[model samples]
Target: MGSSPDIVSPSSRIRRALWPGLWVPVVILLAGSALSFSVAKRVSSQTEALAQQHYHLQHQALVHLVLEHLYRHGNDVSLLKVPLAKAMPQHLSLRIDTLERHTKKPLLQLGSIHAPLARQALRSELDIGGHRSMVTTMPDAQLLKAPAQNLRWLVLVSGMALTLLAFVLSLYLCWRNHQQRKLVQSHRKDLKTQSQKIANLNVEKVALRQALNDSENRSRDLINLSGNLIAELDEQGQIGYISALAADIFKQAPSDLDEKPFQQLVVQVDQRRFVECLEAARADQDITQADLALAADDSEQPVPVTLRLKALTDPVRGLVGFRLSAQIKTRPHD
Candidate 1:
């Protein structure tokens, strides 16, 4: 039988066999890529968080550094000794400059918080006229402002790039996994089809063998039926089969006399004449009949039998078996 195209195709078999190895690695690669992307996003988030935290700490430190600088310069300026309580214009100017210098690029980029509070605190300490006068005194204020502004843009750009890279990696992994899943599905379908075909072939093989065996059994039964009989021949030229009816009259089983030469099994039967008739029947492809008497092996009386013999041919074996039937003659004296 010709196999279906799919079954005979090499590419289809290779697809089935390669699925496990090929697809597993693709799945692993997709998973790894996804995990790495997740980690990168987290790390980028952490970087932004750390940048914010650094801004908070630096803001506090800048305030404290300005306060300390003012205290140390107490003798140089009139309001320095009472700088926290008095309107010290010089100290306000120094504090702003200190803040500008102390804050790093990242802290500056994060920008200031509590701006209103810082100004209020400064106003509370200094007179409004002093604050106005000192605003122009801090050169570092402009220096801090420029770097801080630039740092914000730098951090934002870096974060955006990191986030974009993560998203790209995630998309790549997702697409890779989709391809692998499709391949695996194809392999599974192929395996299912092959398994079904194998099951059908197995069933067909079993059915054929069973049919062959049944035919042989019937033939054997027919052969056995044809061969199960005994025959006899007499001096007048006759040939015949021993029959079940004869065996019953003689009080013996029919099988015991089967296949025995007529002369050997039937005494008072002419052996030569019977052999001649058997051969003639075989040659002519015909049947013959006889009337004879045969002594039971252990008895003196001769039992009369009418016999019939039919030549048989076995087409399969190209040989002959014989068909025989007989009936015994009942006498009043028996």
Candidate 2:
């Protein structure tokens, strides 16, 4: 019988095999991407922290310079102007207020002292010329923003690379699975075709055997009395019939051997050789012989036998099946 087209197709089976494995790379890619994002976020956070620290240090330094200028010039506001302008960063505002050390009362102030509030700021206090003073500074937002943006781009690029790697690996695995599935499907198709051929051969054998039995009763009687096991095997290697002597030799009822593979009665090691002999007989249309070990119903050890195979054929059907005969080989002691 011909195999159904769908059953023989490898595409669907390949897809089925690939589907379960596909998620492995997807999960890995996603996890890798998440890890990359987390690392970038951490780095951005660290950069922001360092930027804040730098801003604080700049503010402290500006406060120190202003205090030093004030002390040198005896709290001269004009002398402090140049140093403050030079030390402060752009887009930042600074304020300095001097207060009484004991009463905490403002004694002097410099700069505008107040500016538009920003999202980021720092404030600190210092003692200058026996007066406690406060310094407040607002940092430029770009200090934190630029590095964060760079980290984001880096993470994006890394995520894309990881995704691409995962995709390539997935494709490779799918392709491998497809190739393996195709090979398996091809092998199955071959086996199915061979089975169909064997079934056809069995049908022809049945017809030929029936014809032979009907045409010659003396030949049947001679086969039965020959003291050798005679058997007919179908193309699929099933026993179509076994002579009474064959059943007695295996210690099995004739009915038990019917429709069973002839190989079941042979020892496992010799079964391959026996099948090769049968195939040779089929190919050459001549008898082939092989030394085989036949299993008996009551014995653990197989009985040594010389197996013979002959192709049975009908003029109309060509090679029908195989006719197998076995002669037990006796030991030297026997």
Best by lDDT: 2
What overall lDDT goes with each candidate model? 0.49, 0.75
Model 1 per-residue lDDT tens digits across residues 76-146: 33433343323322122333321223433221111223222242232112223232112111222233333
Estimated TM-score per prediction? 0.32, 0.45
Which whole-number lDDT from 0 to 100 does residue 231 have in model 1? Answer: 45
Choose the strongest candidate by TM-score. Answer: 2
Candidate 2 global TM-score = 0.45
Error of 1 at 124 (Å): 41
Cα displacement (angstroms), candidate 2, residue 239, comes to 46
Q: What lDDT does model 1 reach?
A: 0.49
Q: Candidate 1: which stretches are off by over 4 Å?
A: 1-30, 36-259, 297-300, 329-332
Candidate 2 residue-wise lDDT, 1-334, digit = tens: 9988768467776766564466767777778778777877887787778877877788778877877787888776567667677666755677766654445443333334233337676777776567576767765555556666687668767877877787778767867777887789899999999999999999999998998877667666887877567889887779998888765567678888899999888888988888889889988889999988887755445678888899888899887788888877853121
- Residue 203 local lDDT, model 2: 97
